[model samples]
Target: VVVVVVIVVIVVVVGVVVVIVVVLGSNGGNVVVVVVVVVIEVVLVIVVVILLQVVL
Candidate 1:
């Protein structure tokens, strides 16, 4: 459905944004911890956002 597609797009966009923001802090352009943090943050944010959308 359109709702599912919207959520998927939002998640992908957030992931890309997180990666871009994090690459700024990596001198070697690669940091395991930063990658993990970005993933978790993105997942959490997306879940919370979706939940809020459903509740309202």
Candidate 2:
């Protein structure tokens, strides 16, 4: 459980950094894309947590 949580945290951190870089590189032009990406990421994380709970 601890290992899974640590991995998830690391992935989320990397994803956030990538998203930030993308948004800044686009100069705010892709605001909609960014929102969609964020929503997708959140959903994926939720799904993973749910699966983990079920399995554990």
Best by lDDT: 2
Deviating ranges (above 4 Å) for candidate 2: 27-40
Give per-residue lDDT, candidate 2, residue 18: 74
| Candidate 2 lDDT trough over 10 residues, lowest sum | 27-36
TM-score of each: 0.49, 0.61
By summed lDDT, the worst window of 10 consecutive residues in model 1 runs over 25-34
TM-score for candidate 2, residues paired by index: 0.61
Q: Cα deviation in Å at residue 4, candidate 2?
A: 0.6
The 0-to-1 C-alpha lDDT of every candidate, in the order given, reads 0.71, 0.79
